[model samples]
Target chain A: MRDVAIVSTAQMTNVRREQRRNEVEMLMPVVQEAVKRSGIPKGDIGFTCSGSCDYLAGQPFAFVSALDAIGAWPPISESHVEMDGAWALYEAWVKIQTGQADSALVYSFGKSSMGDVPDVLNLQLDPYYLSPLGIDSISLAALQARAFLEKTQYTERDLAKVAVRSRKSAKDNPNAQLAGDFDLEKLLAEPYLVSPLRVHDCAPISDGAVAVVLAADDTARNACERPAWITGIDHRIEPHQPGVRDLSESPSTALAGAKAGVASGGIEVAELYAPFTHQELILRDALGLDASTSINPSGGALAANAIMVAGLTRIAEVANRIQWGSIGRGLAHATSGPCLQQNLVCVLEAK
Target chain B: MASGDGGLLSASHIVEYPYRRSTGPVMGRFFAALRDRRFEGVKTARGRVLVPPTEYDPQTGEAADEMVPVGPGGVVTTWAWVSHPRAKHPLNHPFAWALIQLDGADTAMLHAVDTGVESAMQTGMRVTPRWRAQTVGSINDVACFEPEGTS
Candidate 1:
């Protein structure tokens, strides 16, 4: 594989409801900022890829509308995925590897505040069975949480601890929408929004966008003094229905992690796109991450989850840290579908 | 739509699939069975039966058409209690969403259990489906599930 590195990243997050600007307007500055920071002229970028959910935008081909933000005047080569931006980055990486493009732009956006976020997610299910039955995202996650707890030795108190640490850590993240210290006892005393999960255990429903730029080999060296090299990246998926697969474990994540060579080197920071507290534990175990890794130094999805954007944000977080000269290597994970049905793992390094 | 300069200008937007599709061979048979208040699963190469049967086996990716009787009754493998009902939920009262394993099937199905209270639900609990008064060729024909001994 060719040496591809993420040269720059930018984001707009922790917004509870972005009522003024539409997706295109929201993404314009974020994308522009990323392109500018990468030291590559916008016109010189070879390819572009975007990830966003049409259901969240409440329109067909919303991604095309979002292209207005990128100024496709010259009719640039572009592609899209109905998934998280992390997948978009994966596509851009593929484009670079295929020799079709050396430098590429990747972006993802989500505005869950525009609709009934949980119910909107139900539409992604198998229409004949799951969707018609009206199983919203939260209920599905709660069921998975129950199964995870039953199959493992963890309990609600452990989930409460994860929540407390996440929010308290978010206090340092200026872009985090939900951040603060909370007594673990008080959090445990909170009523269940749905049994097996309290409000704290769930991520805040957020509206946000993220953009990142990728350059391969010489282009990467020229674009930035220090690039977060994409040493390994892979994604895996399981059956569509939640019933057939074991919700207690994320086989997809483990498979992806192995393919991505996560265990090849030491990881200083990790960004796991776990929308729920129990899911963090499951992904941690699935990837075989130990105590040395600083998980989610930027507060993770539990602090500000913006659906399609959250996964890509995980990649951007690791890239930012590596570029900032703080961390030598890191692991980032992104997941989609109910009960972690699909997973993508990427390993970034300073070398 | 609400109008305000404080970013409150809002309009309701709804999304729907623009096309209607056939449920295919296996699910068509499953829905037909659902109309008569019968439960069935598709037998796969792995010797497992998947409820809400599909035309293709999840494990082997082979074509699946063998339908077998699975359940009107099943055991709750795992459950999440919902203290308050949502507008779109199958039940209006408190309930639990569970993955239930029918007696003869290897896999489970997602459904709601009208347990009436959180404390009434638990793993390994026996439950049975509650059919709708009006039988339609739809998955909704069986409204939800209830405890085995409940009326």
Candidate 2:
């Protein structure tokens, strides 16, 4: 694959609600910041890819409105994913790998606070069987948590510990919505919102946007002092049925991790988009992370779960770490569907 | 819904979408079962029988065939108390959404549990389906699962 690196990353603060501005308004600043930070003119971006869901906006073709934020006057090459912006970055990286584009601009945005997020996610299910039953996202996740508890030794407290650590980590993240240290024991004591899962186990609803700029070798060198190069990128999807698959583990995630070479070349830090606390535990085991790896240094989804944007934020956090010379090797993960049915993994390295 | 800001004028507007789907035998059967006011579960390749059955075995990716009745009653695997329901939800009033694993089925089905008393609902609670007065070829046919003892 041709060398491509993330030269710059920027995001709007994750908030429970952004009633003042729509998605286009929320995305404009983020796109400008990414281009400005990359030190590249808007014209230099050879391609653009974005991640977003029409369901989140409660309207179809939501990404079409986002084109205004990019100022596609000349009509730049572009594509979009119903997944997350990180997946868009993966597409951009693939375009660069094909030797088609020297640089690419990727972004994602969502206003999940506009409606019931869990209910909207039900649309992602198998329409005939799952949708007819009206099973929303949170309930599906709770079923997974229950299955995990029954099969594994992990407890509700373990899930609470993940939340506590994630929120504490978010304390340093300006874009994070939910942060600050909390007593894990107290969190466990809270009544179950869904048995085996407390309120803290779930990510707070957030509305936000994020953007990242990718450039080839020379372009990257000119754009930033230290660029986070895309070493490996891969994604996979599993069956959609909740009952058919094992909820205790994320096979798709493990498959993506293996294909992305996460285990081959040790990673210094990892950012995983686990919207549910129990999912973080499932992902950690799937990704093969041990104590040495710093997971979610940027607070992760638990700190700022912006639906479509959270996964891209994980990529941005890892890229920023490399841009600042904080870490040499990093792994970033994004998930979609109920109970981690689909996963994307990207490995980054500073060059 | 808001009007698009037409910053750039174009002579023509084009729209495209794809809705091609293969509702395999199982989901086809489930939809057919719904039309008949009956639910079916096919024993998967993995030995777990699922209701509103899946078309393909999740493990082996093979076509699932054995059809069995998932009786009305089941144990709630997990549930969320929905204080504010959405537009497409089965009921407008507050309801407990649950993953209920019916007897004879290894996998669970999601539905609204109608315990008029919200406090009465809990995870692992026993509930039975309250079929709609009129059956439709959709999940809404089962209006909601009511607490076993409640009318």
Candidate 3:
């Protein structure tokens, strides 16, 4: 496989709602900033791939309009995923592996505030059984949380602790939308939005965009001072129905982590995309992260989750830390579908 | 801080995909049984009975062709209370969404157990289906599950 490294990454400050710019307008600066930071001529980048959901935009082919943010007068090899931007990065990396492009651009954006996110996500379920019941995303996560809590030694207090730590971590992240210190008892006293999941335990509805540049070997080395080399990356999926498997465990995350060789080397920092607090626990166990690992310094999805954008942001977060000389090696995780039915793990290292 | 609904120029944009498709044989059998106030599960080659059956086994990818009777009552394997129901939720009042492992079936099915209050819900509670007066061959044919012995 060709050696691909993240050369540059940029993202917008996440907010509860964006009253100013449309999707393209919001993405332009982030994409331009990433392109500029990479020091690569716009025309020279071989391919462009994006991650986003048209459902959020309330229109089909919304990504096509987002393409205007990238300069394509001569046209370029481009593709799109209706998933998180991390998947788009995966596609671009595969293009590099195929020897089709020396460098590729990846981006993802989502304005979750555009619609009622929970109801919108319901459409992703099996139409026959789940969707007809109008099972919202939070309700589904809560169901998993209940199961996880029952089958394990963990309690509701542990879930709250994850919330407290994530929010406190977000204080250092300027791009984070929600960040602050809170009394643990007070947080626990908060009303449950759905049983087993308090409002704080769930990710906030956020609007944001993220962009990253990837280049092979020499191009990667020349374009950036320190390229966060993608040593291993893999994704796995399980049956979508939450009942089919043990909700307390994430087999897909474990499989993806194993396939990506996450345990192959020492990891200093890890950015995980778990929208619900209980899920972070499940993922940490699946990936075998330990006390030495600093998790979610950017507050993770719990801090500023923007649907399609959050997963790719996890990749950029680890890459950004590696590029900044703060961490030597790290792992980034992304999850999609209900209760983490699908998962991807990317391991980055400094060379 | 300021807030106003009419401050920005906007129009209601309703996005919808109003299309209907056939349920195919596997799901069709499940719904057909549901209409008659009965639960039918598909039998996988491994002998595991899957309610709301998938045409194929999730683990082995083998075709599931056999059908078997499941239950009108079940045990709530797991549950999450909905304190304040959303506009699109299955029940308007406070209820619990549960994974019910019906009698005679190996796999659980997701549905609402109308307990009426948060305190009324329990993980291991027994529940029976509340079939609609006039049933259709659809998932909603069962109005919602109710705590066993509820009036």
Candidate 4:
């Protein structure tokens, strides 16, 4: 496989809402900044790919309009996915591996504030059974959290600690939507949003976008001082129906982690895309991450979940830290679907 | 901090797909049985019965054509108490969204349990389907599940 490295990354400061600017307008600056930092001209970008959900936009083919942000004046070769931007990055990586492109641009955008976000996600469920029942997203996660709690020794307090630590970590992240030195006692005292899960346990519905540039071999060496080289990347999926699989454990994540060579070396940091507090614990165990590994130093999805973009942000977060020469190697994870149904694991190392 | 000179304009935009979709063969069998106040499942090659059955085996792509009767009563494999129901929820008052493993079925089905009190819900609680008076050949034909001993 060709050596692909993430040369640059940029993202908008996550907020509760971005009502004035449309999706395209919100993504334009981020995409420009990422390319600028890479020192790769727009014309030189071999391919462009994005991840976004039209359901969030409340329109059909909404992603088509987002292409305007990348400047289609010359009609560049680009593709889009109905998933998180991490999957888009995967597609661009494949394009480069096949000798189709030497460099690629990857971006994702989402505005959960556009409508009732949880309810909007309900539309993605199986129409025959789950969807007709009007099962919103949080309640589904609550079910998973309850199952995880009953099967393990983890309690509500343990879940609260995860929340407190994440928010504290977010304090250093300027782009995070929720960040502060939260009191653990005060947090545990909060009421449940949906039984097992408190509001703090859930990722805040956020609006934002993220963009990252990828260059292969010589292109990567010339673009940045230190490129976070992609040593291994793989994604796996489980049965779509939640009942068929074990909710307490994430076999798919573990399988992907193994394929991505997560445990082959000592990982200094890990950016996990767990939207709920208990899910972080689940992914951590699945990926075999020890207590010594720093998890979600950028606050993770729990601080600012920009729907289609948060997964990609996780990858960018770890890459940014690696690019700065702070860490030698790290793992980044992205999850899609309810109860960790689909997962992608990517391992990055400093060059 | 200062307020912006111009405030943003907004309007309500309803997002919906207004279309009639067929439930298809496998799902149609399950829903049609619901209309008759009965539960049906499909038998897989592994001899496992799947409730709210799919046309093909989940693990393999093999077609599953045998329809078998499942249950009007089942044990809750897992549950989450919906302390406050949303406007779009099946029930107005508090309920638990549970995955009920019906008798003779290998997989559980997702539905609402109208247990009123959150304390009344538990993982292994026995529940029965409460069907709507007017059945529409849809999953909602069974309004919600209720505690087995309850009226």
lDDT (Cα) of model 2: 0.84
Pairs of residues clashing in candidate 3: none
Task: In angstroms, give how far residue A223 of model 1 lies from its true place.
Answer: 1.0
TM-score of chain B of 3: 0.92
Query: All candidates: CA RMSD in angstroms?
Result: 1.6, 5.1, 2.1, 2.7
Residue A99, candidate 3: how far off, in angstroms? 0.8
lDDT of 2 by residue, A121-179 (tens): 88887666677566677767877887787678998888888999999999999999999
Residue pair clashes in candidate 1: none
TM-score of chain B of each: 0.89, 0.79, 0.92, 0.91
Sorting all predicted structures by lDDT, with the top scorer first, yields 3, 4, 1, 2
Q: What would the per-residue lDDT of candidate 4 be over residues A27-54, giving only the tens digit for each residue?
A: 9999999999999987999999999999
Q: How far in Å is the alpha carbon of A15 misplaced in model 4?
A: 0.6
Backbone clash count for every predicted candidate, in the order shown: 0, 0, 0, 0
In the order shown, the candidates' DockQ scores are 0.82, 0.29, 0.81, 0.75
Error of 1 at B57 (Å): 2.1
Error of 2 at A27 (Å): 1.6
User: Candidate 2: misplaced stretches above 4 Å?
Assistant: B1-25, B42-50, B60-107, B112-130, B144-151
| Weakest 10 consecutive residues of candidate 2 chain A by summed lDDT | A126-135
Off by over 4 Å in 3: B1-9
Off by over 4 Å in 1: B1-12
Q: Candidate 2, what DockQ?
A: 0.29
For B45-80, candidate 2 gives per-residue lDDT tens digits of: 677787758667766778779877886688887666
Per-residue alpha-carbon lDDT of model 3 for B1-151, expressed as tens digits? 3444868566667887899989989899999999898999999999999986889999999999899999989999899999889999878889999999898988899999997788888988999999999988888998899999997
